[model samples]
Target: MRTNLDFSPLFRSSIGFDRMLNALEAASRAETIDTWPPYDIAKTGENDYRIVMAVAGLSQDELAITQEQNMLIVAGQKANSDDVEYLHRGIAGRSFQRRFELADHVKVVGAGLVNGLLTIDLKREIPEEMKPRQIEIRTGQGMPKAETKQIEAKKQAA
Candidate 1:
């Protein structure tokens, strides 16, 4: 006997979960989205990681880093004046949004801007019990039956 897995009818069912379905639909749409703001992710040490974003011309006052709902969102806006005239504006001093996928254990420690590089450090401190350990075993076997009695006898004998 053979069973046929028919998923076609399941797709036709109208559960009417429009919002949830829409959000999931948008998830697929997000797969094609990519923003080019060069960045470097480096693991400096055990449980320590750093994210360096190249945000030239963006001051510390202009940048904001926040964690919301498991997303590390780095957003910044260049301080501007509408009345300023630019004879030759080549450098990009515009707004930017950068998103990072953070693991469950990973967390943002702090952030700083140095030499046009915005560095955000993350750490994942696992508990002591969570760390791997070797289990030490003692098995002189059932206490070596005869040997056990001999030691007790020796203590008494002495």
Candidate 2:
């Protein structure tokens, strides 16, 4: 059973969050969820993350990884071979594409395939201007006083 959620109430009061809300709605309304070629996402460090996907039988040349803005795309296409005949086929060798939404400032650092597992590393690098900084507050004793000026009325002419 699938349940649909209404995000209208949240949209009415929130601003500049339309993309997040739309993503939620789209995820909930998806007719079929892909579960093949299982994957896992882990937070290895404070600003570092890793995604490990089980892409058994796929070679480095057969897989592709791309990063566009705040999105990560991974796709795999296996070359077809008809010379060998199999009595029973259990392993999945079909082409698949998976997309992941990344947060602001997050970027893909590196990727490697080992023992049929593809590991992707990511890091969030905040710009110096956007990072939080401590501001020092001055005491009253060291503050500079404002310069004051006095105005006098002109003498009346005789």
Candidate 3:
């Protein structure tokens, strides 16, 4: 059973949160969740993250990773061979694509494939202007004095 949530109340009073609200609505509308090729997401540090995926029987050349804006896409294509016939096929060798939504300022630093496990590293780098800054407060004594100029009247009775 699927339940739909109404966000009309939030939309009326909120501002500049359309993207986050839209993401929530889309997630709720998804019918089936894909669980193939198990993966794990871990937080290595304050701004560092790692994603490990079990892509058995897939080589580096068969896998592709892409970063577009705030989305991370991972796709795998398995090459099929007809020369060998197997009576029992227990292993999965199929093409699959997965997408992950990334937050602002989050970027993928590196990726590697070893022993059928794909590892991807990510880091969140905030711009200097966007980071929190401290403001200095000054009292009246520290304020600069305003300059005043005196005007002389010209003698016209010569």
Candidate 4:
């Protein structure tokens, strides 16, 4: 089941949010997302996150992880081997590609495969210039010394 949302009104009112809105719209239109290799996203710290995917039969060489712009792509393809034969194959080893959208300033730290789980670590490193800072406010009782000098100069000129 898929639903298409009308985002024309939002597009008209919002600015610099095209990517986010487009992602949302795409997600809505997608009826069935690949869930073969189950994954979990966990927040490990204030600005740290980890994504763990169950890749039971995939080796390090069979999986590839890449980040392009603001998107992270994880793809896996099982290598062909004719040595094994099974009457009933239960564990899935199908090729799949998964995508994840990352916010601004978010970066990939590292990735590791332990047991059968592939763990991807991420950290949000906001630049010093982009971080929020407190602005000094002025009260009614006292003006800044620099402002007082400017006022005095204006009076003298008058």
* TM-score leader: 3
Name the candidate, 1 or 4, with the larger TM-score value.
4
Q: Which stretches of candidate 2 lie over 4 Å from their true place?
A: 144-158
RMSD of 1: 12.5
* Per-residue lDDT over 17-130 for candidate 4, one digit per residue giving the tens place of the 0 to 100 score: 998899888888887777778999999999999999999999999999999989999999999877989898898878999999999888999999989899999999999998
TM-score of 4: 0.83
Q: What is the C-alpha RMSD of each candidate to the true structure, in Å?
A: 12.5, 3.9, 4.8, 5.0
How many residue pairs clash (N, CA or C atoms closer than 3 angstroms) in each of the candidate models, in the order given?
0, 0, 0, 0
User: What lDDT is reached at residue 45 by model 3?
Assistant: 100
Worst 10 residues of 1 by lDDT: 1-10
Q: In model 1, state the lDDT of residue 91.
A: 87
For every model shown, what is its TM-score relative to the native structure? Answer: 0.63, 0.86, 0.88, 0.83
Residue range 1-158, candidate 1, lDDT tens digits:
43434444544785654444554455555635545468999999988999999999988999999997557999989988889899999988879898876665678999999999999999987778888999778689745466444344344554
With a 3 Å backbone cut-off (N, CA, C), the pairs that clash in candidate 4 are none
Report clash pairs, candidate 1: none
Model 1 TM-score relative to the real fold: 0.63
lDDT of 3 at 139: 98
Model 3 scores a TM of 0.88
Please report, in order, the local distance difference test score of every candidate based on alpha carbons.
0.79, 0.96, 0.95, 0.91
How far residue 7's Cα lies from its native spot in candidate 1, in Å, is: 14
Error at 41, model 2, angstroms? 0.9
Write candidate 3's Cα lDDT for 113-145 as tens digits: 999999999999999999999999899999899
